[model samples]
Target: MQRVMAMRLRLLQRPVRIVAQSNAAFSTKAPEFSDIVYGQDTGVRTVQFNRPEKLNALTLPMAMHLTQRLHKIEANKTVNAVVFSGNGGKAFCAGGDIRALADNGKDPATRHGEDYVADVPKSQALKGQGLGTYLALTGERLKGHEVIGLGLATHYLPTSEYETLVHYLTGLEFADHVPQEQRDEMIHEALEELETDEAFQEIDPEYLETVESVFGALNDNDTMEGIFERLEKLNTEWSQETLATLKKMSPLSLKVTLEQMRQGAVKTCAECFQMEYRMATRMMENPDFFEGVRSVVVDKDRNPKWSKRDITKVTAKEVEAFFKPLDKDQELILYPSATAVTEKEE
Candidate 1:
């Protein structure tokens, strides 16, 4: 009994090492990292957005840092899984840094006439055509349950369970280090466990029904004007609230967003990205976006006096102008050959 107790004490005194030497393969430092915090324990690497005050809103530098880290992790044979999180408990990420964007447009060096257009619609279209448009236009946030129902998130855990879930997931042994045939069997077992998790099984049906209605409204072949007309007829309180919310958004933005979604329906993912690039370039020239950001993000005033007050006032020609391609130098180059760079020797 004395020998066993001494052995147990020695084990307890030793440092807790979850990862083997093979797993500590990547360099921990990044050349420029301010907006995010990165850490690795065992096989789980965590990339957490660090700006709590701003809800971890994305900036170009922050995005580049994340991309670089992901590439490094991919190359490391040690890492089994990654966890993306926010430093602040309030939000994982609130999306892009609209304030920085507004500032860039104000800077003489960066300001092109087209830099005045809002790019929210472009982002939303990629997420889920019409739904993305609606959320972007209205700046409506989704609750945890709503997010799960929309399939944006695979599982929803209450705040109480967040820490526990993190502990459990990080403790899981990666099948990668195991033999290939056993790896498949291990994955099957993990998936089977996930199938029985209460959070996965308990999606809110009411939220899903609401999502379906909103999607149907946004995807209808009619123009933004016609879609609103139908939405106005629905007698439900939710419909009334949605219309009221829509009324407060920039008229030009709503129309442009609706058009973008309609066009996105038939386009492939790559094609949609191309269309978005065109819209983004054109939006920089529009003044409504500047005013919208000034009111909402800069000034903290909810009221924005848009360039166009009513949706009916926004002409088809004005909407079509956003789709026109920029000059070759200004157009977005989507090819990997143009953007790819070899990693520097450490």
Candidate 2:
């Protein structure tokens, strides 16, 4: 626990920079759902996710549709804010569609995916040479600084879901290191903490019901007590209503929220929103995300063949690479008014 907090603090100590790029690719796709709800009230426009059968899982088309819709809404004068939600009430999104990614992984073109991941080691070696050949040639970037930049400024609300998943996966990578006895002890502690956690108390009982619907039956007995105890020690504070609202919100809103959170420091609420959009674009091509879905959702094999293979396989250089700004060719739409700029005047 001390280690996790220490790691988080170390990660947060970095500078934030907002570089404008092109938004040219945002309109490459079109929306396919008429079931999507649109609202321009309260200066906020919302686009809901609406697909619950597959747990609101996102497909490539769905991702493309979301990107394109966000572009349109950002350009519209009537909208000042946007909300994303899901229909059928199962999930906001379990994450990307793993089945699609697994299918894509099988394609001949995806051979590059493996080769490119292989080249990452070479890229790390290139660090000492002062010229990174891998990034220059592959158009790859670093995320450490970006995460550091984002974590310092991104409030829990917008980036919470994605970061929660990242934390879960990150912790999972270290699970083997923990002795069974310690694991059981931590689990017991977390379970006891759950009883006193009152965030659930304020949420609607019906919404609380939905959580059980997705996670499965809750227990009145001691069966799940250890699991609950372990979770409490981890100090995870999540609300079902907030999760429901996120699930029901529009893809456009979600993207924007994610990008803003990823891009800048979370000094203010407005700043976080601006960062969410940028972060989404970065993850659009990230391998961990796709791999995460494959392990947890698609294959059901419970093993994610991460691009890095192991978390330790992810070096400081590679994590640093994720924060690098996109190449000059990648366009970012600059909504000047959309930015949360509070830079002091010289």
Which 10 consecutive positions of candidate 2 have the poorest summed lDDT? 111-120
Best TM-score among the predictions, by candidate number? 1
lDDT for each residue of candidate 1 in 10-40, tens digit (9 for 90 to 100): 4334332322233354334563577887866
Pairing residues by index, what is the TM-score of model 2?
A: 0.32
Clashes of 2: 54
Model 1 lDDT, full chain set = 0.64
Candidate 2 per-residue lDDT over residues 80-156, each given as its tens digit: 23446676755676665556655665554642222111111222222212112212222244333332232322222
Cα deviation of 309, candidate 2, in Å: 5.6
